[model samples]
Target chain A: MTDIRADIHAQTGASEPGFGDYVTLLKPRVMSLVVFTALVGLLVAPVALHPIEALAAVIFIALGAGASGALNMWWDADIDQVMRRTARRPIPAGKVEPGEALGLGLALSGIAVIMLGLATNLLAAGLLAFTIFFYAVIYSMWLKRATPQNIVIGGAAGAFPPMIGWAAVTGSVGIEAWLMFALIFMWTPPHFWALALFMKEDYSNARVPMLTVTHGRRSTRRHILAYTVLLVPVALAAGFTSIGGPVYLAAALVMNALFLHGAWAIWRRDEARAEADGYRTEKQVFRLSLYYLFVHFSALLVEAALRGTGAYALVGIAG
Target chain B: MSTRTTPLRPTHELHKRRFSRNLGVGLTLVAFIALVFGLTIAKVQGGGTLQAYDHTFRPALLPQDD
Candidate 1:
């Protein structure tokens, strides 16, 4: 049977996709970040939720984010086929059909939104619905192919999860929630542009009009430095909010310094020198950007857990 | 002599894929049902409010700490 199946596969040259292939269509790595940030947002809020309710909220939020990812892959299958990075996605790799992806995305979007409304509150569900629309229709279908400022504007979709999580618990938006939103919003440019710096050809070949492609690498480096300079203050400002404390402030200070220094190094290096060193500084900054967000969010969680305890005492601004 | 060349039903990769998809859907459905049940229980356990509009003092609406 194995021999026969091997011959069948060799003859057909078709991918025998399994259930996992469909799961991959959801962009699980990105969904994990959505889950993490949403969970942190829910946990940090003043209102407490039943564990069951919180679990349901986080799961539905993850589902909503995954559905948007499926919609993005469905819409971008053409460009996914072009770029080496996304070329192996389920749709482009021939493991899934475009129409199937679209149907699944739409169906899951509906289910997630309605179920979240039932599980949490309408405000959270409404935010999730808008996020899906923003990512699928606004960003994926329109801005991604049309503008160089694509990520600049489109970063809102990724920034909204924590806000949704906050609304889920409190049935409203608050300043602390927006502070988390701003953290991700500002961090996105430097993070993605860093990836684009190293992966320039991929975006250019796909004609995605990324900053690195449209504005040129030198300008891209300058933008990275500018955004990093801008990001530092936004990150530090969170420490003054009700959710902030010594731990969060300390994490924000150290991470922002490292991030800003890396951006400065990237800005100082010339194309000739960057090429000589194989874009090491750009790549390092890209890797650091991941940890930078992780550390900030983790610090928020720590501060929330420490609330009302002696250890939670003396937040610089909260006090 | 038994006339058997291929098995009655030859195993195929498509069958495996189909089985996995069906299993995933089935498990997900079960999980969804369980969640709805759990959510309902949690909501009920949270204690219902006295009809705010009616303002009738329903003893049942109050927490049973006494």
Candidate 2:
């Protein structure tokens, strides 16, 4: 079916990108994060879905995430063309047309939401739909270019996967779900700000009003530290919830301590000093931030395992 | 002076490179389709896999006194 006309590149003055390029547009790495977090949500929820149903829910959630990624790429292709880091992305690189990405995103969004509903419940599906629109339309199209707080408000989109996962099983949200949401929501500013610290030039050149670009690296650093303080408490609190056990609590305590130390180091460094030090502190924090969510969720799984073996009793025994 | 010709050389090299690339693409595409299919089928068949945590901690496990 990949005939000449089906290519759609020659007539549009665009190049025919390979399959890999289209996959790249989906932001598989980000989707992986979504899948993991949503898995945690589903697992930690009060109810237990069937094994196959749980897997299907996570897959649909991931598809929703990928759909959001495609739409974000489509909308941001213009700005992406101007940013050095993003210039090589499929849509901006002319490997994939923006329209193709848009269509793929819309199709996946519908499929994911519908399938999630069929497999699970309306609440989970509705939440997934909201997450897609929040990321694609509200966050990417409107907030990203309009304000420095874009990531702050838009962080909700990334935070929704776990909630959606929880709802998939329990068919509702509770404090635990929101706690998971808070953990990611608070973590986002500092996580992306660390990248902004090093990639400020890219944002500036692209004319995107990132906090670092608009308010200066110093202000961004301050914000990172502040958010880190907020995140640590929220993340640690999640450890005390019904889903949490000794394993998760210990992990959260240690991980959050390390995260704070790293954030502090970033705040203390002068730009030139940081440059000379190769931004190692920020880079390390960024890497750890990636692991932070995964480890926390995995620790919850550990808690579940313990509960299974009758090793540890539920802490709250309520909620 | 240089009359030696390895008869299988060109075909062997072509096959090696082509096979690897084809294998890579084929594996990736299959994995993607399988993931989607597995999820869809799982959804249709029985809802979803129990989360590791869920299987470990069932609702029945709650204290009977409550």
Candidate 3:
């Protein structure tokens, strides 16, 4: 069966976009975060999964996350065009048609959810569906333009992967799963707020009503400090869970202390001082926040590994 | 008889992109098929054995008198 569209464009060549543009619409960086967190969730669960099943579960989870990203790109194409950071996206940059993105997003969403249900369990599949809906419809369509607390609420969509991953293994959610969810949920405001501080002009220009846009930068700074202060307890409390051990406690303590210091520094600064330094402190906090979550999750992974080998038992912290 | 010429000229850039797109879709489909096949095999073997309506005289699994 020949493609009539391709045949029509054959001779003169309409410069049809290549497949990589489709991949770009998936937002690979954000997909990496979803993959990592979900992988950690699956690996650290109490029950051991066959390696092949685990890999398949993670792949479907990632595809589900990517589908959500594509849907987000489809829905937010207008604002994506307006913002400098997202101006070159496939739809906005004219590489791919908006309808193409919407079709692909929808198709992939169905495929990922169905495949995940087949590969794992219905609960994980259902959660992926909800995550997709939350990001595409709830967050992108409604909350983003509706209010300043957008990311605070939208962060739940991102936070669901670990819970889904945990469910994939155990067939149900648990306290530890919620703890992981809380880690990302509490960390999101402080993390994105730092980026909003540095990228303040971008949000306001797009009229997305980021905390910095609706609330003043002073208030945004205060919110960042407040969230950071609140995030510390959640981050540290994971250390006492089944996933945590001495390694996690140590990492959480040091990282949370630095995080608090960074937040406090941002809180103390005035607009002129921040502008003079090119928002260096804000940028540093943002960078540290990236490492903060990765380090915490990695520490949890390490504790899980040590526990598996009875290393924690020697130190009297074993299950 | 009109000669059957290829619709897409080799020299055209769109032809190249079209080729790339087709190849990408082909590879992705193949990978998906492979993954599904592998998953089926893995699930059947490692996902626990399927208990049919009746196996080869499994007296232990048969319903007992009350």
Tens digits of per-residue lDDT for model 1, B1-66: 675344333457666786887898899899999999999888766646645456455877677885
lDDT of 3 by residue, A1-319 (tens): 5755466666445537898989998888998999999999998999977787788888889988898898899889999999999999998898888888899999999999999898889999999999999999999999999999999999999999999999999999998999999999999999999999999779989999999988899999999999999999899888888888788999999999999999999999999999999999999999999999999889888888898888867888665
Kindly provide the TM-score obtained by chain B of candidate 1 when compared with the true chain B: 0.61
Q: Model 3, stretches more than 4 Å misplaced?
A: A1-15, B1-8, B47-66
Per-residue alpha-carbon lDDT of model 1 for A1-319, expressed as tens digits? 2455556667655666678888998999999999999999999999899999999999999999999999999999999999999999999999898998999899999999999999999999999999999999999999999998899889999999999999999999999999999999999999999999988689999999899888899999999999999999999999988889788999999999999999999999988988888999999999999999999999999988788454545543343
Instruction: Report the error of model 1 at residue A52, Å.
Output: 0.4
| DockQ computed for model 2 against the true two-chain complex using alpha carbons | 0.10
DockQ of each: 0.40, 0.10, 0.42
Whole-structure CA lDDT of model 1: 0.91
TM-score of each: 0.91, 0.81, 0.91
Residue A34 shift from truth in candidate 2, angstroms: 0.6
Candidates sorted by TM-score, descending order? Answer: 3, 1, 2
Clashing residue pairs in candidate 1, if any?
Answer: none
What are the runs in model 2 whose C-alpha is more than 4 Å off?
A1-14, A313-319, B1-66
Among all windows of ten consecutive residues in candidate 1 chain A, which has the lowest summed lDDT?
A: A310-319
Interface C-alpha root-mean-square deviation, candidates in order: 4.9, 11.2, 6.7
Docking class of 3: acceptable
